[model samples]
Target: MNPTEFLDGGTVTVSDETYTVYKTEHPESAAFATIQDENETTVVAEAGTVSGENVIESEPGWKRLTFEMVLPFELVGFLAAVATALADEDISIFAISAYSTDHVLVKEEDVPVATKKLEALGCAVER
Candidate 1:
């Protein structure tokens, strides 16, 4: 697919809730979503989950921005554009892609900067 076609998924929305990333052992709770890798389990859970001695490390104060369109399975460069835009401005991002959509996480303090850069790329941002 053409690179420009990637941005067709429009209107990225920033989630109001704050998210914390935790490095921990396997979390058995199904109440929250968790992703695991061999090195550590990355947990995106309620603030309460950050507690407990099981957490080996943690990064708090993250905000999520989700692209609101159903991206085509074959599309490419969607994330690159967004990430590059933020990176150019020295904003860091943690990105995730599911079957139909993409999500990006940035430091809570950088939400405004991230949102503005995305808008400059012609993406309507809702924060």
Candidate 2:
């Protein structure tokens, strides 16, 4: 795929809800995203949604920005370009790739800069 074609004409939507990343011992059904391995469970859900003894740590106030395009499996460097753009601005991101598209979680305070960086890459960002 052409890099320009992959970068341009894509929509990135900022979610209205704030999320939290949690490291928990148990699964959370309400989590927006979850990953479990032999040692731990990582959960990303709405802020203040998950609690109790199972949760080992939590990082709150993250906002999700979703790439609204259905990416082809063979497409490459899409995320690398985005990550590099943001990294240049010193913005950290937690990325999640679903079957159809990709999402990135940025600290609430970094949304504006992150949006601008993504926009610079030719993505139409909706906040």
Candidate 3:
């Protein structure tokens, strides 16, 4: 999917909360995002809520860009399109896709650059 096709959502909001990734069991909180397997579970939660052992990685200072666009489940390459745009600018990102939308996380320092890249691609970005 190309960026232009998803521009109907029009606004992408950058979250201010700092999130961290934890290596643990199924997270009990709905506030965070998680990916789980037989061997491990990766939980991305607000920094303040994470505590205990097996902390895989802490993304302490990152910003999440929420794509408000209501994407069809059948749509393809949307994340790739966004990632490619950011990667071209040397902005690394961690992405999440939910039932209604897609979100991308970038280092706090790279938020501005990420925003610019997205905007240039026709995505209206809001911080």
| Candidates 2 and 3 compared by lDDT, better number | 2
lDDT per residue for candidate 1 within 33-65, as digits (tens), equals 578877778777656556567788888888889
Looking at model 1, residue 98 earns an lDDT score of 79
Q: Which prediction has the highest TM-score against the true structure?
A: 2
Per-prediction TM-score to the true structure, in the order listed: 0.87, 0.95, 0.87
User: Stretches of candidate 3 above 4 Å error?
Assistant: 1-3, 25-31, 54-56
Instruction: List ranges where model 1 is wrong by over 4 Å.
Output: 6-9, 28-32
Candidate 2 per-residue lDDT, tens place, 1-127, comes to: 8655866878999999999999999989999999899999999999988976778999999999999989899888878888888999999999999997899999999999999888888889997
* Model 2 ranges with Cα > 4 A deviation: none
Residue-level error in angstroms, candidate 1, position 80? 1.2
Clashing pairs in 2: none
Which residue pairs clash in candidate 3?
Answer: 1-76
